[model samples]
Target: MTGPAQNALYAALFGDPQTEALFSAQAELAAMARVEAALAVAQSQLGVIPADAGPAIAAACTALPIDPQDLTQATAQNGVPVPGLIAAIRDRMGRTPHAAHLHWGATSQDIMDSALALRIGPILALWEGRLHAILTRLAGLAADHADLPMAARTYGQAATPTGFGAVVAGWGWPLLDQVQAMPALRDRVLRVSLSGAAGTLSAMGPQGPAVRQAMARALDLGDPERSWHSDRSGPGHLADWIAGLAAALGKLAEDLLLMTQSGIGTVVIAGGGASSTMPQKRNPVGPSAMVALARHAMGLAATFRAAGLHRQQRDGAAWFTEWLTLPPLCIAGGALLRTADDVLERLTPDAGAMARDLQIGQGTIHAEALTFALTEHTALDRATAAARVADLCAQALREGRDLTELARGAWPGPDWPALIRARSLGQAPQEARAFDRAVRAASGGLDQGGS
Candidate 1:
């Protein structure tokens, strides 16, 4: 029978050739090959093997095609490193002296950890690009809609008037913070772990340091002070970063879902999904999917964190758990990024609806500002002016007249209307645009492929 179907995310990550290229299984395999070559060279240089064999072993490794099935079977039997790989290389050399130096002075963890670093390098690059694209789209939206006022809700109740740009800025600020934090995360994820068995390069002696430096350079990973066979810092830090990103995406998705509600109608989605059963339904499918994927990614990160509590010197449970957890986290992150981009792209702002909603609570949003304006001209105190404005607002709502007209009739001050309007919004749009410009400049001109 066919095995249970792989997760749809797996199909996205590993089945689709274009997106699958981001993960680069070949790059991971090549990293392992380089580690093996580095180990042989280090061994030869340290007098553990004949110096003449180093170049030949490196050449043989470069020429060999690794059998993936053999590697899988070996991983199932032992924890890692199919003995078949070394055996296959030895057979190719046919009792030659260079064949004897295949994987000298290194253990399986060296290859596996370097492979993880190689995998993370490409993934982080993709993340930085995707996140910048999404943030730029958000910034553009905020700039375009900066002055369009809408009702702000807290605890599901209408509170005050706020611009759509303010809402977008709320999401943008956190995203900017997350983007700033990514470089450190990238460094942590791209660290090379090349210490031989038992967290020491005892097998390669004095040449170990040089070999590790060379391997890191070849693989484009950072060199660590020592091997972290059981330290578990890299994966744990990666999990934390992934979780934080997912949380931010989830917040944005939640806001989109709320803003698209039928009652709100401040924003409309283009090309939303329609129900197969009900032709009248236009569903917010993209935002819904983002919320689901964010939840999944956060849960996977929790699993990774739990796996970090494994016992010393490589716990099989923790290591194997990652085989199931890490890939899904990567896929979910990719999906979230793609969905955020699409959602921001297709969102249509309803300036008319926002204006209508600002007028919904019977001019309550203008109450305090009107009160302060009235306080300056009248004999009344602040509280009395507030009460008088509240009474006038209630009377205007019942009598079906404009609150501003009523205020003008009741107030004798010549500047009352202008003062109230001026305080309605004070420099909010300018501040948002400044913040957006800073984010764009910091993100290197909104280009996805920039540094």
Candidate 2:
């Protein structure tokens, strides 16, 4: 029997190429290269090695080619890349004792951490692009449907009337806020880890600081004041950020799922599934996928958070869990963004149904505003006007008359006609427009950054 087909991600991360080339996998490899070079350079500068050897070490480290399969096999046996990588470099450099300076003051965690930062740089770029596309699509949908009226649901029951734009805006604003915070969050994830052996660079003497600074410059990462060998705050914070993004998408997906329900029939989309069993059913594919993707994201995010609870020095179990968690989280987020873009792009507004549902509550949806308007022309207080409107609604329900006619006869208010006519909407359009502008502006900035 054949084994399962290899996934692209697995091949990229574990393949035999000198470079992984894929964003996440390459990050780990790049970090390793940078740390190795920096350690050699630091040793030469501090007079621990021949000055001429520094340039040779840097050149060899960058250009050296090793069998990826060999590294993989070594990792499987020893659970780390340093052992195999060291052997490969020694082989390339021959039997010269100078090769000993290749990894002079560094440890396994240093290279691994650097690799993680390299991976984050590219992953963040991908995430930013997905976010911009999703936000831009949502803005367009909101703008096009700004004045389109729809039922406002509270607790799964129709409570009032609102515009479709407002509903979309509610989802867009919070997501935009998250986009604005991404750069800082990325910085937190890009910090460099350079402490050797234990939490201190004691093996490198006083030159550790200069070497660390040079390493940070070479890799475009920040240097923490000291080693964070056991502190998992950076990884934990990143996990939380990802989880928050998933939650936002999940909320949007939940709304689309409900709005597209057959019973509600408030929202319509093109190219949804046609049931195989029943030839007549048009399934809401976009919303359904959105819901599924969001759920998957939530589960992976939970795993990422759980992986942060490792005890000091580094728990292999918890650290290894990240290998399982981060990739799925990234993939799920990408899928959700893609699905949301498709869903919003093809969404069709049902103006007639929205108008009809507004009257389902016996015009109670418009009653609150009408009551406030009536108080201006009559001696009755705000509460009295509200009571009068309630009475008219009850009578209309019993007598089968329009609320507008009942209000005119029973309340004798001058503004009753205009107030009743304006009841089918609220602040939804204005909110949608404002949200659209914000989303476009944010997306513009992200696009400028090539996200």
Candidate 3:
């Protein structure tokens, strides 16, 4: 309850249940046990332990009834849960001949890190599912509103006209890149760690590398070939990926936050939060939470990266820092993705309000279109045409008239509506549909390790 992610009051708002469960103490213990079992079997297969010991150790690891609560005091004393875990497993084996072979030549870091890698496989799988759902929803949004015109803003002011589809696509391209990078990321980060003690398997002598490879194959993980005891790059890469995903989702949330403002209500979010004091308030709760979670991820990512500064062969301080930072960082990322998917599911674009805002500044949004038409169809140069349009825009604002009308009065030969339409949403529709196509093509590969 001390952690906001698991706190009863805040869990629904900020926590991701699946992510929490994966990183939970019980889950960690199970993963560690799995690692131990794999290590035992691998050692036995490589002749480092007795042939009969492997199955016995594996069975014990699977069937041992070691509660996580029983390991807390030991974990606090030993700086890791593996010692207590192995002890509990050995005790459960009860002086059996194979009990001595359990966790042989393996350090606590080996079990712990390998267990984390095991858990990461399912976590990545979860992310793949979420990404597929999110991209599908976003593609639908883009296709549905491919030509729906809206005022595009820059620097907190309306700049020009754009389609809502393009705006949605902007939020999707980064995520698509993330999806594409999943395979490489998994290869880089989801590797087995089997460095014994000071990263050299001295106890197992020459068969150590073989044992490590066997364990990696048994656990369906990548083998780094060298010990990563002092190399924290794997975890660092994961933190970076999580932060990047959060930032991408945050960008969408920030745009939605602006679009849903009181007077500039271009996007309507259904099921907005009700303000207790205000009778007419529909606060953007999901976007707000996404933004907050994204910012939290940013800070946690920095700390996580710093934890990569491990000293020499092993640094308990840096390792402990990672334990403190990674779980919450991962949870925040999951919540952000979950919230973004939910928000996109309920989002509705207000065409009427968008139209109102498009013409809010006396049709000045079309000034760029007017300037381009003046240059293309007329004799004026680019600078001259731009200046002339600027004058017309000022006149339109001063006289409270439409810039289009004034521009047409000055230059009548060009087809105004056709010209404006051609220039306003130049590549927005195409861009949106391109994203839709990309997502569709990648859909089949998303679950298969991003191909």
By lDDT, who's the top model here?
A: 3
What TM-score would each prediction reach against the true structure? 0.87, 0.86, 0.97
- Tell me the lDDT of model 3 at 134: 96
In model 3, what is the error at residue 409, expressed in angstroms? 2.6
lDDT of candidate 1 over 370-397, digit per residue (tens): 8877777677899888788889878877
Clashes per model (N, Cα, C within 3 A):
0, 4, 0
Question: Candidate 2 — which pairs collide?
Answer: 27-115, 27-119, 28-115, 129-451
Score candidate 3 by lDDT.
0.90
lDDT (10s digit) by residue, model 3, range 1-451: 2488899999999999998899988888899999999999988888999998998999988956777889989999999988899889988889787888888998999999989998988888888789889999999899889999999988988899999999999999999989888888999889999989899999999999999999999999999999999899998989999999988999999999999999999999999999989989999999999999999999999999999989999999999999999899989989888888899899999999999999998999988887888888999999999999999989999999988888779988777768888889989999899989989989967555564
What TM-score does candidate 3 reach?
A: 0.97
**Candidate that scores best on TM-score:** 3
- Per residue, candidate 2 scores C-alpha lDDT tens digits across 1-451 of 0111125553322121211233343345545766677767767876767786777777777856765666888888877877788777778778777787888778887888777777767766766776777788878878999998787888887766788888888888878877888878876788888888887888878878777877777778888868876777787777777677777877887887787777676778888788889987888876776676677767877888888787877777887787667666666666566667767778877887777777775666667667877776678899888888888878877887777777778766475768645745767789999999998777777667724
Better of 1 and 3 by TM-score: 3
